[model samples]
Target chain A: MTNMNPSDKALVPFVSVDNMMKLVHHIGVEPMLRGLADYIEADFRRWELFDKTPRVASHSAEGVIELMPTSDGEVYGFKYVNGHPKNMKEGLQTVTAFGLLADVSNGYPVLLSEMTVLTALRTAATSAMVAKYLAPKGATTMAMIGNGAQSEFQSLAMKAICGVDSVRLYDVDPEATAKAALNLAGWGMNVVSCKTAEESMEGAQIITSCTADKQYATILTDNMIGAGVHINAIGGDCPGKTELHKDILARSDVFVEYPPQTRIEGEIQQMPQDFPVTEMWEVINGTAKGRTSNQQITLFDSVGFAIEDFSALRFVRDHIQNTEFFMDLDLLADPDEPRDLFGMLQRATQ
Target chain B: MTNMNPSDKALVPFVSVDNMMKLVHHIGVEPMLRGLADYIEADFRRWELFDKTPRVASHSAEGVIELMPTSDGEVYGFKYVNGHPKNMKEGLQTVTAFGLLADVSNGYPVLLSEMTVLTALRTAATSAMVAKYLAPKGATTMAMIGNGAQSEFQSLAMKAICGVDSVRLYDVDPEATAKAALNLAGWGMNVVSCKTAEESMEGAQIITSCTADKQYATILTDNMIGAGVHINAIGGDCPGKTELHKDILARSDVFVEYPPQTRIEGEIQQMPQDFPVTEMWEVINGTAKGRTSNQQITLFDSVGFAIEDFSALRFVRDHIQNTEFFMDLDLLADPDEPRDLFGMLQRATQ
Candidate 1:
């Protein structure tokens, strides 16, 4: 008879892509987005307790692979993500991700999950949650420039968290806008397909630019962003990539996730080295001001910090308990006698 | 019927720990170690092509979690590992690991496997391979200074690759020595258990010190190490952990894997910053001299590097083809249209 504890230690809960989608449907997307936003906000409130560091990145001419790790004393989490803009031309997703959550007490992995869907969810939840504090009061409209894989999630997250009801979608590729609009049908938002980026911004209190390209293309110019609108610029996330013009950054009150990382990978990378920016955690903690006046322009320059992923993993860990959305994977070697690893290998044949 | 192409893209091969043991038994351990050593040697020969960076680590008072990533312009791989010395008391392995190999062209993971067992195998293979090049000519006996989980693998690897026929084992705990000796029985090698570290080194041409503890430790002093002996000191793999006295290092020709990491984490952490050392890749590439004379003392200060893990993953990826040792895991979200991730999630319930 096989002992149970070694097998228990061997089995890590693995949330496959199918299971993750099932979990999403089980919880409902809107409620899951709201749950993610709540966890992110709570983590942000106690940000000082976290062990934060800039993501370790390995860059190539074609793309980049990054490892983002963080710990909060009790648990540790990390995401393995790759960003390749050229992948879409070959009928592949431009970004794919997987992540793990481990118990910090004994250093054994407890959960492993596909984060491609979860990252899109948490990123949108983060944008909407930030907009709740920084956007124009009672904001119900958003201009989503670049209607691609992330557009639907960003629109729905705003609808769920910040009560935004309408989305004005625009993309250079007209089929992208149609695709996003088609997928978001019957979900919960009024989605408008616009030909021009300028036309998409009509009557919108928030503008989110998430174009996936490797170049330093300015999708939004200084004149494009008007006063009192919060801009969520995420596509310009690596070195030598920025979406907004520098003059636009000069006019906006920029807030970032983590200063050390944001200064290198966010929209603030285009600005001067000493550019003033507020850390969003302090704003959420009430130590720093967010939106002071209706006429002030605000920009949330998110480069996807590690703490946000840590929070999302925590949310998934809490949700997968007593649920059938994950499989038990024997991903760690747990010998009956910890010192007899070879004996375990020998006994496997018996 | 649902489409299969998108589902194909979603699958990644995962080798669980149990399956890893089966794989080990299917393809015997000695052959696998030799294969891993061959891959590692080839990688070291072409080291310039790889993108090598120090591991990203998160350290707490309890332990450390590290992510080591490397790419050779074609394929990318990374390992997620944790080291917590206090874990054995809680019935958990002190070190547990998992790894992933990914395609760089489109940025998707190709394989995910348990590396705790693989790491032990590869670490032993590396030490044996190094001994093949640096140990005294026709060396047949080794003194394994720590009889823990790694002792049997190290002893056997030397027997397989370096022609060592006997291992004299020593550990502070007598039970550990007995355990290792029991495991190595009937394996065509003579194993001896010793009470003290000094007694184990009698007539041995190679000394492998792999004690497990977190401190400024000196398991071997200068007087204990004889001339022309190759010392494999690996147990002290982090800051404040050293297994050899500084005087012993001063008298030896030190070879290291990635000097930047070794200076901080290897036995050389106790040495001066500008202490002379040679990168092992240079030796493998024939650019540097190794063990030039019979009377010269050689010390291989090993603090495992990312390239070795990259090589180990490469070996596993090649071995799993046409083999029933791995399962296809749905770890990536692949939509039919690539952009309709929301639709993919929506259809999972049906």
Candidate 2:
């Protein structure tokens, strides 16, 4: 009666942070980012089939913990993420995440993977995918104004997915900018370190701001922006946190992942309740126009939605098959007789 | 520059199902159940300090998957559980679950454990703890209806926590009754396998009905209950599933875990909007009465709540401290410099 070994149904494929890094290098970072962008794009093309809700969040004085859940009928997925702005001072990542994918039929988790790296990858891929629809034609350079943890991922994603050949990096902390520049040195793209946000935007057709302040900070002022460039404003993600001035929102045609969520956590949170925005999925499916004119400023106010994480986990679940990148985790209990859970426990005394 | 090993901060302790059984056997099951009951009672005493919300559930044609989350300011916890009633026919556990406990201050997961077995333990402990307050004095015999997965745990908990010495088991399926009686054979108690529900209730002071049908079920009717008896009805957890008849609820003094949740998922869900019920926490904290007289029928409408799971995970987190019942999984990404996540990933190329 003593069953010491777990059966196949009891084990879930788990991709740890170490194995995730190995998988990333095994597939090459740029190509992997491109592949993730494709997956995000595919999900967006059929976004109407997904079960979408604003992520459930628990806020504290120090930080916020959130659960983002979504499903595409056949498979269900959810991500556990936390953001503590002060964690950087204590030598910890300001954001950490993990996610799971489960079968809808049996409600058993099939894959569990660390998403700290995957979140960074998926976030950048999402921005680049939206840029492919909204950026100015032949855009070759981008102004990266954060230079924090997500800076390099955003840079490489744009270069790989959007054909951006050059990147100008800037941050309030010079060391952060130096670190990002050093990391992107051999990524086959021309990297430039700039002293000021205005200097970073020079000769760039795309301006991506992703700073790390919990409060509302004006990283991009209205007067500093010019026409005919795409603005990817991702830094203003939480309430009381906005990167672009309200006047800039008034001047650009904004595109968002999900309006209900973006209204609360994106730059549009500063706008009126009736503020107009286009959903990116509509643009991907050709139901709505994207970048109608090169002279019109296209702003992608990305707060990161559940569907993106679902797509990322879906990609991991599919990619880890027949590979040594994942280990079997005994996460579920499987008894010979479903109703005899106690009998199994009793036999475990052996 | 390549770092081959994860840092101490990156690893999180994970308890698999096998480890959970080992932990349970390391400390005897009865002692662990009593320990969990104490932890749950202590949490109930401070019920006002918790941040509570109804579970977030995603329903499907086959079953339902839910995330139950709660935080008590310093520590946060959530459980992912699925209830697929049809899974029994497919030789799968009807309910499977896993849970995590995290530090609210830093938002880092501290412990991850398989909860299929722990949930059974906690649910039974909760029932018996409530019985300690509401059952008639010197209650020694219990009628155990629905001898399924939770039957053995319930019987032991009633014995360990409430001094119940005899258990009369009855199920529609005779095989289920035989299996439960077989499992409880070694325990120091009088176990009687009854052919009918009426025979199981002979001289019993406590009647626990935990049938697993997804629709409205009537395992206990109004006439089946007698004066001065404690009714623990636990299987009516989902929106449309209930175990006890509504007439029984109207006749008894009903008590519940959390009223808002119980009204939708407990036996009281069959009653009207204004039906009055007492909260069990009030009874535990001395704000309300439990069993006032020998002739009054007391019913514990158990739908299960997030706080119970939090307490259970808390107990696991405390008990597995120095034991080898857990393994550290590299679940989080710990960069030496928080802002250099890309730099850390680049160094992993070694």
Candidate 3:
């Protein structure tokens, strides 16, 4: 690591979307997800050092666009992400994102990255990180509810990080379930495509709900959950969106990534305002309990947070340092004479 | 322009920093500022239609980074900006920014522009717009305190929008004053470099403080002001940064953008919790009073609202549509099948 010298020629490495895809391809997906999970867990253990806030969102009739920003004194990062559920009908991804990492000392963007793929990786990595603590030891089976764009990453991350040996998947569209099953076929895990949510949860140690409908829909009921099962609730991530029944939330030992934000966007939104829940960071730090008994049920209400992206960026930055996968962007204007901003503009014009 | 058809291929126009500077050069600074002033005033008059919020800020030890987001339902916009006052000492611009405008229906970015240059222009335009409403009629003389990078833009904007023909400028660094004067030499306005703030304000109708220091330095005192003067306080935008003394604010009719944000970042921070200030939109909308008389001191305590940037993005988008000074950026991913995000990765990997 470089010493904290203020005057050192600071290096800000950026990976564009195309180049980032190349980097992922070079390293392979499973290894990248495992590495990202490790970084996320390590950062979560030191969560007190970060300045965090709920993402600021602007909602329109069609969808919502949000800015999720966070800083750790030395480096500041933010992602501009949009979620339009109906975008796929127009040949667009349901979500698109871009982000910037800046040097805190100068407030200059050192890295500008396409985060559409990175968000998928980071979100899955966060799920596995939470499951690493809450899920039963040597958990071998996972039930994936809703096989959409996020399904493949979630399946791979769970297999790679949590040692899941098989995944039972279900989606409203059988074609989606078939697509997920086909993707996971060569990954050395048993992929079981189920017809219903109840059938998917059979003998599963971890149940992941990542459906994309924008309303509160019950994908998992309390009766469907068995004891000692860890529920990775992922899709109920907005104000009006929910997945699990309130009974399931009330019965399980609920955990979340930032209590204030989770209260607004997580599955726990259906719970009472004064409902009790532990922050996932506390579990990662070992200051709070995860599962004390083999018979206890655990639920991790995972709404992606900025700190997870911060960790993912840190991971990508470190791994790509010795490689040429990063690109130098003309995002910040630097003048030879500090006061001559207009001089830089003048030179650029010429 | 495309008849607002949902299925039509809408043109996505962009202006890079270089292209924006060329546009400014081509259109002339006075006319560009005048056009921007018109856009800002029109947007401000319809403020209730906007989805407004206090900019989300991520503060670090060296400086602060902010995400300013706003929407008018049909279009969504946000600006990513950072301010590090000490950056100039390291040959970097103190503020660097970029912004995006998107279609609310699909959450697709319709325009992406470098906002560092546009921010300076829009900020000046906003100041001039507020001064047009709050300043005395036939205001021909102005005092510019802290003549730094933004001074020329302010001078040109005021000359075009408020008919200010002469400006008295002062900076702690004489070199900055010389630079400002040099940049404004042939701009058809008279520039006088003054030795101090007190000397600069003599016989001036508007007093603008755009200092760079990050502390409450009291650049303007109550004793330094004359009757009927309009103050366009530009700097001191973050917490712990202020330019006007409390006594000056106590006597002047202070106008702000958003009250909660202004209370924390604007010169109003120097006053009590219950201090009264008018939202500038109210005055622009004619719902509240502006300057009551020629003798009433008026102050526009601008902390730079998100709405102004929203207006600027709209202006840039429109102008780019009418011109050809932009490069198409593949910022979003288009998948043949929305559920096949992994397929795009798979194809890219191949």
Top-DockQ candidate index: 2
Pitting candidate 1 against candidate 2, the one with the higher TM-score is: 2
Candidate rank order under lDDT: 2, 1, 3
Show what share of the native A-B interface contacts model 1 retains.
0.72
- What tens-digit string does per-residue lDDT give for candidate 1 at B4-123? 334778899999887788788888988988888999999999999999888888888888888899999899999989998888777778899999999888789999999999999999
Clash number by candidate, in order: 0, 0, 0
Pick the lDDT winner.
Answer: 2
Q: After best superposition, candidate 3 residue A336: deviation in angstroms?
A: 3.0
Using all chains and alpha carbons, the TM-scores for the candidates as numbered come to: 0.98, 0.99, 0.93
**Model 2, runs deviating above 4 Å:** none
What 10-residue stretch in candidate 1 chain B is worst by lDDT? B1-10
lDDT value for model 1: 0.90
Worst 10-residue lDDT window, candidate 2 chain A: A1-10
For candidate 2, write residues A213-288 as lDDT tens digits: 9998999999989999999998999988899999999999999999999999999999997999999999999999
Using DockQ, rank the candidates from best to worst: 2, 1, 3
Better of 1 and 3 by TM-score: 1
